[model samples]
Target: MTTRTPAAAVAALTLGLLLSSCALLDGSTGGDPTDAPSAQASERQRPTPPFVRQGRMSIEGGNDVTFELTVTGLEHDGEYLMLEVTHNYLEDLPGSVTGRNPPVRLVDPVSGEVLRFLHDPQSGDEPYGTHFVPGDPAMPTHEGLPTTLRRYFPAPTQDVDYLTLTGAGIGLVPGIPLTRVDAFTPAPEPNAHEYIDPETFAQEPELPDEIWYPDNPPPPGLDTADRRQTMESFVDGPTASTTRAGDQETIALHADEMFAFDDSEPTADAAQTIRAGAQTLRSHIGPRVEEITIVGHTDGVGSDTHNQTLSQERAEAARALLERELDGEFTLTIEGRGSAEPLATEGGPDDEQARARNRRVEFTYQVSPGADGSADTDGLASARRHVAEPAHFFDELEPVTTLIHDDVDLHVYPMVRDGAYAFQMVGLQNSTLSPLEADLDVDASAVPGGPAQYTQGTLGGFRVQEPDTGLIRYVVRIRTGDGEYEDFADRINELATGEQYLALAVFPAPAPDVTEMTLYAGAFGQVDVPVR
Candidate 1:
């Protein structure tokens, strides 16, 4: 993201200030230095400071509107943190740049935790944050003007100094300085066409309705209690992967990797893979884990009856090996899902890969409390040391690669590690004379229905893989206000010709020593991308 003030606006404001100073110095009107009229005029004409971040959004009629955002204050006020920002528009816009409820979040760069806007339970669970004032009429667009808004969020730990602001159409703005203050202070309004010196800007009177303090408790609503982190890891060779959400972990072993053709007997490598999974369970099992469930699934290829029997036999085979390896430490149960539940749409664009993923046997269990929900190093190392099959997906092109398809050009950039997440930005350009919609959604028909569904025209399918371990990292899931999880990327609709747009994709941060990984885009194949 980049930031700057309009050059023309700055020049015009500077010239006006110069003339005002000359008139005062020459005593042309014999006005007082602090005259109210002169002071008011200067205040209204004062130019705004350079914005900290800027982004462009395509509105109706294929018109692109550029929006600038400036953070005036991010202060800690005992109970919660108060955020003040100014939104500036460079030109007239037809629609609201940010809807009534903007999907904005403050991401802690150190812990990789995301903080969302607080909600008020007393008021029908309405969001505690808003850009419009209560009594003022809703103004969708200011038309070459600026609007100042305030929001509240739970404060991070004291050791943190900066956070990244993401979502709401703007690209990721990293390195936002976090300031500590005794009390919350209102942000000064910004001028759309003028540059204002920070020292000269005057603070407005505090609003009478401002009531977010300890004396007046916030509305009863959800806080950080429901906060949880989800991480996923895919083994390179065996079509095996693990997804950890809080204390629960699910290990997925592809059926194709475990069975020979349509047979239920374990393949030569199936015993070793099952043993690796058992080792992982033994390492993380707690007193609460009395039973582990192993479920088998198949792709949409075979008849329902045949798939059901095959899935059942496969689940039993996996359970048999797992039980032997565990040595009676835990009870095992098995089930056959057949072709009922899938992780991807079977007949999607990437049908082969999608079907390969769908045909899998999953081991689900709960880990010990307080245990860091991450991949078990010993278990992963054991799998790599024992399993001998090659990686299922390989990178064909190197980082900073460009792929042109369907009249749209996509430039994939190198990935950057930010705390526990890997962030990458892809540039999109429309090559045709008219607007073009990018096919970005990964087939998420398997996703349960909800507002958090990633298949709703989003970059949910973008993923990264570690070349050495073949650990594939899917886009991180975000907890929506309704408590469902969704992909943490923006929903891209269309690309306008002659306009450059950025798409953001975030995944679980790979190991510190791993400097490069392969990115799997839906139709773009694989690119060997560098990680910094």
Candidate 2:
């Protein structure tokens, strides 16, 4: 599932800072599964409601301040009201709202002066209407936080230019009463959702499962600086509404218009329906959209990957249409699954209606104020200087032999020669004064060999003799072509920190010519030395 967010800009900035401090990659933290609200700012003070003159209305127990307009006696089929609204009433945000191009006029009814609030808060050039959709109760012209109310109105009417409200001031519909639902505070902003202590920005968070694998390296293509943006990503729920129409379950997509698939290319009627659907989405939702992820699903009739691709393509096609027709207000990301994620779990093949429902595009919204702009990051920005990067054995030289040496209780394997080597070994404690010893066997093959041919042999057991004066010498003997003795070396090193394996690699003198070698105990064999 795709995730979208509202304060993604801030979240991204904060996340980037945390990731830069630690090192991680950019990707989603999984959507909706973690929908905790932000805890960045201090508690918002109880808001003061806007005043209206027509009738008496109060925002009951709800914390959100509501502006109620009683339409009991107004001599008309509908009504409208105008007022200056700002989202962040507690703070004065300059340029937070703009009317620059296509210059807008916010005519204040009382003062006759243009009052500009943050962003454009109009559904259309109106008397914002109060017409109710069928089955819906005769409700207010608007309901919800100022942002939600402005997002969708029943219908814009001629009686009002526009009904404006701040995030704190919500315009009420005619009959439905306003209520401040709860008093819960949002959680603090996380430094990194799955990577660091969400509260204490400096600490690391519980890591995800993928990081534990030795073979899994951090993805290289992503900009580490941008990883924080992933924290702000989230899913905002399904976009299409499902309901029963006639004998079938129908899903009405919220967009400019609605369209039914009949045959080749969308009909004008279908196009119009899509247009209306899109319009509905716009009127009820602003386009501060970061990414519009569309996932198209299908009935299970093909391979999982194929179905998945189909579903994704369906979503992509819908997104393409939306972007092309809607002035490119959204960045569309599309995906298709032929038949994998199904909405109806118990329906039979006879249920074409249910199958059709399953084969649909699911829309999710991701929001961010600075999605396209440079958001001020939360912490000090710094650069990381890597001491080294991994090099490959094939790139430097080819391995003539691949060896697998597993002795009782110990196992080691070499995949590439003359590169990095790794193995596991455990020492045996002997009762005799002499220490036990073992040799590493090798298997070689290839072409060229005379002595010059690739030869494999064993080394080590360089003689782990009796201890002397509390000091011990562990020797490593090398072997070359045709079981010939090579060179021998010894290390009177410290008793390893503990029983473990070690891995390292060294370039031999050449084919059949044994050069230097190393033997390590414990799991430490993965050591790679820089070849200068």
What are the RMSD figures for all models against the true structure?
14.4, 33.5
- The TM-score leader among the candidates is 1
Clashes of each: 6, 72
Q: How high a TM-score does candidate 1 get?
A: 0.66
lDDT of 1: 0.56
Q: How do the residues 402-453 of candidate 2 rate in per-residue lDDT, one tens digit apiece?
A: 2233331222222111111111112211123332332342211111111111
Worst 10 residues of 1 by lDDT: 18-27
Question: Number of clashes in model 1?
Answer: 6
Against the true structure, whose lDDT is highest?
1
For model 1, residues 1-532, the per-residue Cα lDDT tens digits are: 1122222121211101111100000001111112325544633433222225555645545556665666666776665766666665676655322231125677764454677655555544443444222222222333345555556777764356556666654445554555677666644342321322222322233222221211112433336544323323223333576665545667888778788877899999898888777777877779767999999988888899999998899999999998899999988999999888877676755777777777788899886744433456646441221111111111121237787666777777666555556677676667888887777535423222111223333567666667777665667666554556667765566666756566677766666567788877766666788765
